[model samples]
Target: MLFLQNKKFSFSILFLLLLLTFQPLSSSQQLKKNVEFNTSKKDHCQKQISASLLFDITLHGFLLWASMGFLMPVGILVIRMSNREQCGRRLKFYFYIHTILQILSVLLVTAGAVMSIKKFNNAFNNNHQRIGIGLYGMIWLQALIGIVRPKRGSRTRSLWFFIHWMLGTAVSLLGVFNVYSGLFAYHEKTSRRIRIWTIIFTVEISLISFFYLFQDKLEYIQKQGVILGSDLVTSTDQGLSPNDKQKELPTDPC
Candidate 1:
């Protein structure tokens, strides 16, 4: 009977030890699983948040670029071409079109600004944001300047024109640069492919530059032709005899 009791006690001790040894392993496994699940949940949440941010950023970025980068330059080009046309009616038509396009651009930019403010809660924190704010302010100021333009013959007209031209050119160039920066930011934030956008933007800028250069050369040629024609006419008149010159002169209607 003593031997049986001792054997039973030994078996009990072994059983307790086995339980003790396995209990910690089971708990540790459960804890590890819990931690992994929590980590996965966190990763999913982060992905969702980043996706939302990317959507808003891309939408507003496109709008901002369209308004300031694309439409503004096109408006300026239209007005420039109108000036070259030198026809009052055509000029007036294009002037109205330019104004309408610019107003549309301002509206688009305003919408984009609102979207950006809603998303970021602060402006001018980053380089892109700072440039965007400056561009917005300058655009509105340019519009005001257009509205308060001096009369064609006013003494201050030249000064106003100079200021307007310089300001407009600066705004356009800055806007282009800002768009590029915005694209980079978009790429960084979302890790989406930007090669296509970069290519498209490069093509657009190249076309615009080519058109500007061609137009400039064409204008220069036209001016030179006009000057040469006037010189030839003057020389021909000088070569004519006095009687021929008098005969060529317009007679007073009696």
Candidate 2:
């Protein structure tokens, strides 16, 4: 009987040890399950973040290039051809294309400016945004000025032409600056390509305008015995003519 009692006591102790060991293992398995659940949730969140980034890039990238290439140039062309006298009567078809392209360009640019603000308001700031806003306002005002279509003979119309010309030139210069800033900021392969082409075109146009027009004027003044060089080029004020109050030729738009 005493031997039987010892066996029962040993069996009870063994059973208790087994129960304690199994309880801890069960709790560890539950903790592992919780960790796995949290890991899956984190992965899902990361995927969502990636998807949002992709969407913004796809939409904004398309509009950015489209406005730069198509709209700004069209705006300039529209202003240049606003007068039928400038373009002969038979070239009206070309003017029509010019008008249509200008309208489309303005619409696209307006839309793009708004979308850019929506997406990148925080990212783009300083002179870049100010220039863009100024360009947008100037282009819209230019379009309005275009509708009046000034007649060269009328003094009032001539004054209006001066105003339109100044505004148009301002907008064009600001647009070019804005494009330069954008390309610099991005510096992607596409932006670099545009930067190279822009620099080449700007240099070509500048050289042509300086030599063909300004040089001829300078030579004519030189023949009249007026020495000319960088000083005349840097002059801020337009000095009065020999007849100080005489009206310049109506042919000069500015």
Candidate 3:
């Protein structure tokens, strides 16, 4: 009986040791869980990076569009239209519009330049970056030229205007080209579509160009219409003084 009791105690102790050695979760499972968690963290980080890049791109593009595309073009149009008008107050109003719009455009451009320097990569390897540098320099130079204008009759005034006109034209052309290049760059970087945006910009430019060309010929077109000269002559005869009528009568000399 004593031998049988020892055998039972030994069996129970061995069972307890076996239970102590067993693990509900293995080391391999814990490693796999850690890897999965780390993978999810990395994925979340990538998503945040993409979102931030997208925001930066959107803001930069908006600034460029407002500055170079919309505001500057409208400013040019206002200045051009102002030249066709003779009223002083109306001319002043157009001048004010042009000045304010240009100032706003410069501010927006400065903002975009700041953002580009801070947020974007400065590799300068692409056409977009190259053109942007030139375009911005030309814009600033154009502003300076506009500010230091000579009087209308001065000898240098003509030269100044020539330079200003050329620079303005170049900047406008280059700005539009840069915008197109930027769209392509964005697509290259983010693999996104830009067809509709391109189309919209093209249509807007076309309308502005149409108005610009049409305004120059508008006066000529108006002059081509028929006039009522007979009514003007009758009105002039009715408004004549009595002495002027007496001078016109030859029968009184007889």
Best by TM-score: 3
Please list the residue runs of candidate 3 whose C-alpha ends up more than 4 Å from where it truly belongs after superposition: 1-25, 226-254
- Choose 1 or 3, whichever is better by TM-score: 3
- How far off is residue 213 in model 2, in Å? 8.2
After TM-score superposition, the amount by which residue 213's alpha carbon in candidate 1 deviates from its true location, in angstroms, is: 2.3
lDDT of each: 0.88, 0.64, 0.87
TM-score of each: 0.70, 0.55, 0.79
Give lDDT tens digits, candidate 1, residues 1-254. 99999999999999999999999999999999999999999999999987888788889988987897788888888888886776688989998999998899989988998898788656466898888888889988998999999887899999999999999899989988999999998887678899999899888877877876776788899999999999999999889999998898999999
lDDT of 2 at 122: 48
Residue 75 Cα positional deviation in candidate 3, in Å, after optimal superposition: 1.0
Task: Specify the highest-lDDT model's number.
Answer: 1
Q: Rank the candidates by lDDT, best first.
A: 1, 3, 2
Task: Kindly list the per-residue Cα lDDT of model 2 for residues 53-87, writing each as its tens digit.
Answer: 55664455445445544455544554344433455
The list of candidate 1 runs beyond 4 A from truth reads 1-45, 121-125, 223-254
Q: Write the per-residue lDDT of candidate 3 for residues 1-254, one digit (tens) a residue.
A: 99999999999999988776654346667888999999999999999999998999989998998788888888888899888787789998998999899889888988998899999998999999988988878888888888999977899998998998888888888888888898899989888999999999999889888988988988777665424566677788999998999888887545
Clash total of candidate 2: 0
